[model samples]
Target: MPRLFTGLEISAQTGLMLSLLRGGLRGARWIDPENYHITLRFIGDVDDPTADEIADALARIRRDAVEIRVNGLGSFGNGKPHAVWARVEPNRALMELQGEQERILQRLRLPAERRKYIPHVTLARCRSATNQDVARWLSEHGGFQAPAFTAARFVLFSSRSSVGGGPYLVEEAYPLSVAGGLGDDFNADAFAGHDFG
Candidate 1:
């Protein structure tokens, strides 16, 4: 079995900027810069056959590349702060891509996501941080922004069954094209030389 998700890996430059936002907040377990990503759909633990089906289905997606921008910082929690993240600027292309993924997963008989999709690159996990602590941290780094970058592809990432963030493995990748077709050069192994960190 593998815990899977489809996501856009952050550029190294953007990851570096996000890494700087670490610390100050107590009980914050900062995620490694290499693990920063905007998740499209989280496909929880699945059998190997199901995972293969997911990969094959995802390979058929032909959406164009998306221009991603990291804008502002926010926390997710009802009362006690649970996590801090860098917000992904809203864009039609990004939404369409995620929506398509949602439909595909549901068609495969997977359960729908309970929470509304909010694009964000999680920066830290807050275990015992309070509302006051989160509010103060947000006040200090709320203006955080990163240069816009084009996401040429999305990847299928596998992570260990653990508590917090990654050591994620890029299992496969699918290129995005304006022409709505996979190019002949599309290689699943093309992620080899790239550094997600």
Candidate 2:
């Protein structure tokens, strides 16, 4: 069994910003740039049948694409500072999408997430240390912001451990229809410079 999650990839520019932040932090494990994502739902380890069922459910979710912005940097926990992450600017679209995904899973009796949904993109993982370093980092970098962009789809990813570290393998994708297809006006230029595969 493998752990799975639904999330959207961060843009290249945003990824570069995260990489810079990682370099200055102490006691932090820099996350691979390719692994950066805003997680919607974590399905944990499940059997093949459950994975297939979840995939099927995800495909049935209907929503238009949305513009989400990545803004600010922060750390979690009071003393140890377990994690550092890029905060998502508050957007109803992101929250609604998260809620929809949760409802779909709950219908299948998947256990609820113990923690509340706080939209963020993990930048680093921290181990035993005072949060003083984290506090200073946040204060200095909190104003960081990325260009607002439309996320038209999400992926169901499988993480496999390797000699280097774990790499996220996208097992499936769920497309969001836009107005050109579902109420969103898309700019092909936004994707013109990128190679997804």
Candidate 3:
């Protein structure tokens, strides 16, 4: 069994910028920079056969690369404040990709996602942090932004049973055809050195 998800990996430069926003929030476990990603669909735990089906279905997506912009910061949880994340500017390409994934998963018999999709790159997980703590932290560092980057690929990532945010393995990869010369210089080597932790 594997816990699976499809997501776009953040570039090294963008990861570095997110790393600078790590501290100051007590009880918040900061996600390692290399682990930062914008999830398209979280498929949760799945058996081996199901995982294979997911991979096969995702490989059929023939979409073009999407331009992703990371801007501002916000936290999840209405009153409890469970996580802090970087906002991903909503764009049609992103929504279409995510929507396609949703439909594919549902067609494969997975339960439909109940919550509406909100694009974001989770930066940290908050355990004991309060609403006031999260608010103050947001107030101070909410202006965070990173240069726009083109996502040339989305990955099928798997994680073992553990606290979230980290050590995700790339089980499979799906490339997006580049429009013009947008992703001509992008290469997997830029994301290869880390230990996946």
Candidate 4:
């Protein structure tokens, strides 16, 4: 069984920019630059049959390529602060693409997602980092922004189910160039502290 999901791949240049914010904050395990992505939907471990059906359904989406803007920085746990991420500014195209994925998956009988979708590219997982620690870190790096990029494609990725950063594999890719199409990936509840798998 594979742990699968869909996501938008971040450019290496953007990843390098995001990587610069790695240290200083104590107890943060930064994700590798290669794993940097904006997840569109998390499809948990599923039977091969369901996976194929999902691929087929997703490939049918038609929407325009989304213009991604990494505007700022934020943390998930609020006062508790479990994770930190680069915010993906949500717009109509991005929101609709994600919403379409949500509907398609629910139609596949996957349980409806319980959390409101918040678009973000996870930067690090917080471990024992204090409220003050996070606050200070946010103050220092909150102005983080990457050059806006056009997402021409979205992909279905598979990952090993394990703790500690990712080595997520791309299983299927769905291009977002059909005049109109959906995006690639997103997470469970962002505040829920999920990795990019």
Candidate 5:
């Protein structure tokens, strides 16, 4: 069995910027900068057959590369502040890709994701941090923003069954195309600037 999910990898430059927020707050277990990614669908522990089915199904999704921006900071767990994250600015392409992944998993008999999709790159896991601590951290770092980058691919990642901050391994990658495929929206201008030698 493998615990798997699909996500978009961030640029190292973006991850390095996010890494700067690691200290100051107590009880924060910072995720390694290399592990920073925006999760699309979390497909929990699955049999090898199911995993293969998921990998095959995902390869069929073809969307244009999405521009991702980390525009702000936030946390979950209400008063307890269990986690902090660098929020991803949501746009149509990103939402569609995530929704496609969710639908694929559900069609394979995986449970539907109950939470509304909120795209974010988790920064830290809060262990003993209180509401005040998280609030203070957010106040100081709330204006943080990373230079936007276009994601060329989404990946299937495997992880050990443990706490969320991961030592994830990429199992497979699927590229997004500028040239329209199947149901993808066509952009004729995508070819305009290219030098086809």
Candidate 6:
């Protein structure tokens, strides 16, 4: 069985931009730039045939590409720390996509997700952090927001571990045609968070 999930591949350019953000955090275990993505659903480990079925189901998804603005910065823990992530601004388009994908996965008979949907891109994993450190980091990086970018397609990815990192790979892409074809990948250099003025 292979680990599987659906995600939006952050283009090479976006990956670079995200990498730069990670550079600021001294304690951050910066995720490899190549593995950066916005995951829609995690399908866990499954057989090849189920993976194919998942791809087929996802290809039937009919929705145009959406505009996603990456904004805000936050960590996900209190007391004993766990992880840190970049949060996305909530909007109808994002909510709809999340709900739609959730429903699709449920129809496939997967277990119901325990938590409510909150869209975000995980940036770093924190083993632990002191109260003072967390406060300082938040204050220094407050108001962190990435410029809006378009999400053109949803992908079914096969994740596996390697020496560099473990369990993240793209297997197939199911595009959502909006206007013409998918929009070009946003340039990281253009949106590089420099000065943030």
TM-score of each: 0.91, 0.86, 0.92, 0.88, 0.89, 0.83
Model 6 lDDT per residue over 94-170, tens place = 67777787888789887877877677778777645655665667677767766677877776766663322335755
Candidate 2's residue-wise lDDT over 1-197, tens digit each?
66678887676777787777666667777788878888899888777788888888888988877677988888789657988899887688788888999999999899988898998988877764468878877888888888786788777877753322248877777777665663243333333221112
Residue 147, candidate 4: Cα error in Å is 0.9
Best by lDDT: 3
Residue 32 C-alpha lDDT in model 5:
92
TM-score-wise, the better of 4 and 5 is 5
Question: Which candidate comes out best when scored by TM-score?
Answer: 3
Q: How displaced is residue 90 in candidate 3, in Å?
A: 0.8
Can you write out model 3's per-residue Cα lDDT over 1-197, one digit (the tens) per residue? 78999999888888999999989998899999888999999999988888888888888999989889999999999879999999999899999999999999999999999999999999999999999899999999988889998999888898876758879988887888786754754776634422222
Q: Can you write out model 1's per-residue Cα lDDT over 28-143, one digit (the tens) per residue?
A: 99999989999999999998888888888888898898889999999998878899999999899999999999999999999999899999999999988889998999999999
What are the lDDT scores of the predictions, listed in order? 0.87, 0.76, 0.88, 0.82, 0.84, 0.68
Best-to-worst order by lDDT is 3, 1, 5, 4, 2, 6
- Candidate 2's displacement at residue 143, Å, is 1.6
Off by over 4 Å in 4: 178-197
Clashes of 5: 0
- The model with the greater lDDT, 5 or 6, is 5
> Compared to the true structure, candidate 4 yields what TM-score?
0.88
* Poorest lDDT segment (10 consecutive residues) of candidate 6: 188-197
Model 5 gets an lDDT of 0.84
